[model samples]
Target: MTSSPLSPYLRDFERLADLETSVHSLLSSHGQEATFHHVKAVAQKAAELAERFSGNVEEVSAAAWLHDISAIIPNRERIAVAQGLRLEVLPEEADFPMIIHQKLSAALAEEAFGVTSQAVLSAISCHTTLKANASKSDHIVFVADKIAWDQAGTPPYLPDLLVALEASIEAASLVYLDYLWEMRARLKVLHPWAKAAREALRADVSKLQTDKSLRF
Candidate 1:
């Protein structure tokens, strides 16, 4: 299919279904069965979040499905692949190329799946390390990915994050960003985007709290 932005609702639904099927085949053929399952879990969570948070479900689901599509590229090759794609290779990504998969996935979503919508591409690009001023779709996918994390057991932060989710996407984002912030020391490198996202979310959450106080 030719690359185009999201279409009207009906077309989007058909296209999104095709995209999901294609993602499954791609991941499975690449021996990324576990990642495939994780993407499905994230997509489910993203749909629920879109409902609760008033996000665009179609765009959010597309990003969720394509967020890790580039995992087929080995970590060692990620930097070179990103450079070849002309994607910006952040200093942090060069040191830990695994972090660059999000950008590669976004590229694949556009190149292979014809996902040209900026909303979907932006969300896919930042699903791992959310950027400052994230859109509702970005917030939804980011939080949903964390909620349905690929790690073996249940995410320990799920409970608190869920509570925060009930308040707002920004609130839930803050919860996860804060967790990472607290553990920044152990992280290979705290991506600048993540740091900016955390600070932005802190401001957003504070405004929410202040608004609630005024409503009382």
Candidate 2:
């Protein structure tokens, strides 16, 4: 029987959704439904933000669904497996794999599901943690993750975060750096990749300050 042709992105989304559901089910078995819900909600918000920014809808949606697949595995297991595979994980990430499940999710999407597009992989990979060379899609995902609607216990003026994000890329990047810095401090730990992301933003902040000084 001749089958209807689906776009490559549509096919990827379907496969990714199924994979995400399976991962969620595994997490539910471990009584981590709250974590699953939080991650899923972040992914959904990220996709919506991506659409608003003229991003590829299917790609961002699929990235949202698959960005935390590795959380299905234990944190210790993730560290061991990544180490055994020589994946060059940062120490902070290895210690807190739960916080950076997107890296493993990207690998699984590529190796298991044949999602070889670097853009999609990168969006998935950097959804939780911004990287120095992050693409537009990466920034979209990162912002979406931070602004998830389901976020509870948020301050009253939280919508200002989105306003700041809309103002300029530099403003948005500063907010992201602030988040990373706060998170690192709260956890009392650091990861090499996280440090690099922080440094990249510090450099941007410096340039912004320099430009202001020149104008003055």
Candidate 3:
């Protein structure tokens, strides 16, 4: 019997879509429809934004689909799960361990689905807090997570973020961090990663501005 063979691109796309479907089904079972919707939106948003930046769309999309897989974990028990797995926790995460979903998602992605691409795994890992040394794919998933929210009503931060995005992803990320700082962070409770990201982004923007000034 002759079987039609899938091209590499089609094969990869199908793989990613399949993974997304499984995650969706699992989320539905757990009543995490909002999480499913958010991750789905993030996948679409990553694919869209990747066109402008020449990023790996498939990688970003796959990472987005799996990034929040840990939402299956109950909020109250996330710390215990992480502890059982012997994962290290930051002070803030120890206090509010719900944020440990990032690490859990990465671990689950590999253990459950055999996803071995470091780029996709890295993107999945950092999509939540966005480590200071995050890659381009990481930033895409991170930004998409915030911009392509699940709930009703437009997020206020999206407008200014769109304005900054018109310039560049770096600019948009700065706008995002600025909004985060003004909103919950200023009132207190900024993640250390966010604080570090803000500092690094500010430095990058300042250097760009300086370079522009020198050219003028």
Candidate 4:
């Protein structure tokens, strides 16, 4: 028996799914199973969250799934690789190479899967660093990466994040940033991206408050 032709949406999803499968094959054996589960969770969360707002669901889904592709590289060497990629590495980023995975993942998404959408690439690239002026797609992936998956034990900020999700993507991101800040503060090791996210989200959210203040 022959299978029926896939609908456009199904075809698209399947094509991306095939790429995902290839990515899985390329993934190193270490922690592959757990990483696969984490990526799927992040993709689902990114898609759902993007749908709640006017984000690019496709971009969010793809980026979220592929955001950690470079994790195949050992975490310890991330800083060395990251430094080699850039001429001037920031002190904080040089100190914490794990953040380099975002850029490496974005590059891998492009080279491996031919991802061209800046929205998608930007989401992948800054998912960790969360550069200033992040688009909705970027913000959605960033928030989903945190709220959907956690390497640490049960995330203590889930309740706060859920509340923020009801409020807005900007709000959810702020909550996540706050969670990161608390974690880093306790560890006494702050990644540059965390600082960038905090400042960017604060600026983004403050605008709403400023507008409300003027209206009242």
Candidate 5:
């Protein structure tokens, strides 16, 4: 697949460098080196997958770099920032404030960085939990995010987690759903989006199980 025409605009090395510097500054302010490293890994993975998929390499790279821009702010501040930018978000989803970072990122891309393409914005927003009517770009970014290969030092099960994601979207979604359930149980905060994501994956799991039973 040929990359979108927007590729040139995104691949400007100077622009990407500025974005990286901005991200580092934001993370430094929050004293969150872990988050910075995670985003950097995600960006690297996004770039590799974008090249393979012949995606708009520049747009995908930019999206990956800025996907978590709003996460540096406090949870309460995130909501206000998102609202100020006219980003859409659900009230119940407010608990995991970082989730809104995706939307805020798109806004920043447009207002601050002169990015006006919907494809770029969609790719960034859908990197976490996907929304309905996702485009090919969205799917590419989503898969890249799930299969990021920088977890070598993580627990043994982490590799398996990536393997499961690569094997099937249903399997990956089920695993994510289970993980979310455990998080909610332990955190005592039932984020609305988290619940919704679990329910969606649960339905997928049910369908898969039913299909397997029929096959047997």
Candidate 6:
């Protein structure tokens, strides 16, 4: 299905309720209360950003709620499950399989949840480490997830991230990626998608700044 099957006129009054119900039930059944709460927070934040940015709110909300549905899978089996689903296994995913949950979650969103929108699936596929040329909905969900982080306290980067977000979604994404790049030494392996995304954002943001400088 297309990235957007539901009309913008319907807003959150339609599929969002059923999607939330299904996701909540699945997470509860798995005893993943923390994940359920985190997804809810992300969905809320995503919807808000979608409205602010004139993005596809329905697609963003659906992806946000389902983004972490695969977290219940044990990290050890993540690579296996991703392979079983016929998802590409990056070298980084092989070394640190936990990173594959994003892809697994997208697969499950389609297989189990019956989600067909390519936009929604794509957002779910890269919510953790956003890819290059991400759509507006992708940016919305990614930034929302960071804004509503699962940690006990506010994310250390939230203040800076929010400031960047006010400027543009790409800027906010770059802010988070910059943090990840700074902490790369501690990461098990840096996913190539994330690396490419950071470089793309750097170039995009620099060009935007340069264009603005020229205009003024």
Model number with the top TM-score: 6
- The local distance difference test score of each candidate is 0.85, 0.65, 0.78, 0.74, 0.63, 0.85
Score residue 213 of candidate 6 by CA lDDT. Answer: 100
The digit string of per-residue lDDT tens for model 4 on 64-85 reads 8889877766777666655554
Provide the TM-score for each candidate, comma-separated: 0.88, 0.72, 0.86, 0.83, 0.64, 0.90
- State candidate 2's TM-score: 0.72
* lDDT of each residue in 147-206, candidate 5, tens digit only: 653345544335555667566544554465466566665764555544665676667668
How many backbone collisions does model 6 have? 0
Q: Tell me the tens digit of each residue's lDDT in model 2 across 22-47.
A: 55665575567876787788777766
Q: Give the TM-score of candidate 3.
A: 0.86
Clashing pairs in 6: none
- What's model 6's overall lDDT? 0.85
In model 3, pairs of residues that clash are none
Cα miss at 105, model 6 (Å)?
Answer: 0.2
Clashing pairs in 5: none
For model 3, residues 78-184, the per-residue Cα lDDT tens digits are: 77777766777788788667667888787767765678999999888777677776678888888888798766899888999999888887677778788878887
Better of 1 and 3 by TM-score: 1
lDDT of 1 by residue, 1-216 (tens): 552221111132223357668787877767899999999999999999999878899999989999998877888777877787677898999999989889888887886688889999999999999999999999999999999999988887889898987778888888888888988999999999999999987887688889999999
